[model samples]
Target: MLELRKINKSFGSRKIITDLDLQIEQGSILCIVGPSGGGKTTILRMLAGLESIDSGEVLLSGQPFDPTNLKEQEQVVGVVFQDFQLFPHLNVFENITLAPKLSLKQDKAVYTKNAEELAQRLGLANLLNHYPYQLSGGQKQRVAIARAMAMNPKVLAYDEPTSALDPGLSQQVADLILEMKQAGMTQIVVTHDLDFAKRIADQLYQVTPVE
Candidate 1:
């Protein structure tokens, strides 16, 4: 469903990703594992269209995908940053429902249902009305996941989904990832946690510096 062909990204004298190539099959969960400064998150950023590719291309569903086009890219992908980017003032449901309502112009019913359903699915049913400040670290991350899932995109790109949470919460998040995979949510998770990646990813793609 997704393909990255010879993707190249650089910063000044430092080239983060050089001639990197990857193919993510439809309905498959892929995990990218690498140490810090190894260009793991850089790859995800490029995939999400947040960063432009200096060369090559990212293809989705056989079409050459360009992240530079925001509208087109937003329609096809939902991304969860390592830092939960939820609105501090908005309640959990509101945080999850905002994107669909504002960006997609989805009906109120659709937004409500999507938020409620994902909240329940992500074990955030009881925290719907809670503000980000009121929630614990784990709850906040789940809110972030729920917000990402609420978009119902073709692919969910997770960048360090569990890096901040405690072990127990990370396990919970891992279990939720398993459920998402079972339900056939095509995902690409960029994480340093190899064990977590192994538990969730159907295939693993390890990125490294080219000698």
Candidate 2:
């Protein structure tokens, strides 16, 4: 389980999250839903090691989780940004394998196989040669997901996954998330779409910005 204990965050004098506590069970999907600027994405960023909390602690499986520890964070959590940040210069295959190739430093064949399997599972097998700009929004989003999954993190978090997709595509994403959950990957989703949250989350958390 992942637990946030008395978490507090602020930017200058403006507080964002204050005295917040949350627990995320393993192999479960937890959706954080709220209005704009409610610090939902900030929580994901903290998990991704992109942001820092002013006070409190993050614990994963009863062990201390240090957000400043890049290596530890990389192994524990994977994040999919709202913008689906794919490398414009690299093709789908390259984009998906680049991180593992650089970070894992294992046999190229191992990471290659993992990337291929992820692409196939996410329905990007045919688009391996395609660039981000060449694919549609949904395809790009899938590629982003595949890239994150390639790292095989224990927890995956997404920020506004369905913001750019229509209802049909949103449902498809929801299904994919559920499939991941069945595979024992714990997920945290930050979205404003309550309907999408209801469709996918095993638990719902409502966050409001601290004034």
Candidate 3:
């Protein structure tokens, strides 16, 4: 389980999240939806250990790690950016394996097998040698998903996954989220797309600004 208790965050003097609390069971999908600047992304950033938590705690299972320490949470969760941030110079296979190899220090053979399996599952098996520039928007998004899965993290978070896709593509993304859950991957999705959220979310969190 993942739990965020009374979490608070700020950027300089501007507070982003205050007194926020959330709980997500393993293998479930949770969608955080609200207007822009409601600190949705900040919540994900804190989960990914990319932002500092000002107060409260973030827990995985029953373990709490320092939110400011990337090393503490690096292997516990993975993130997929909205832009499908694949490396421009690396091919699909390379991009997917890079983090696992570098961050986790997994052997090349290990990450190679992992990447190939994720690519096949995500329908990118044939695009292994293709670079980001050659992929369509949907394909790029799939590649991003594959990249995140390669880390074998217990939880995955996506930022505005449907922002660049048409309705049909958005539905596909929702289907993939369900597939991930069936495969026992916990998910935290931050999006303004209500229809997409309704299609996949097992739990929906509406985040409003804290005064």
lDDT of 1 by residue, 20-137 (tens): 8888888889999978888898888877767788999888888986876867316566788888888887988899988889887899998898888888888899999899999988
Q: How many Å off is the CA of 70 in candidate 3?
A: 4.3
In candidate 2, list every pair of residues with a backbone clash.
none
TM per candidate: 0.93, 0.96, 0.94
RMSD for each of the candidates: 1.8, 1.3, 1.6
lDDT ranking, high to low:
2, 3, 1
Tens digit per residue, CA lDDT, model 3, 6-107: 987888898888788899998999999988888999888888877778899988888887656757326677899998878999999999988888888889
Identify the candidate with maximal TM-score: 2
Q: What is the lDDT of residue 24 in candidate 3?
A: 98
lDDT of 1 at 143: 88
Candidates in order have lDDT scores of 0.84, 0.89, 0.87
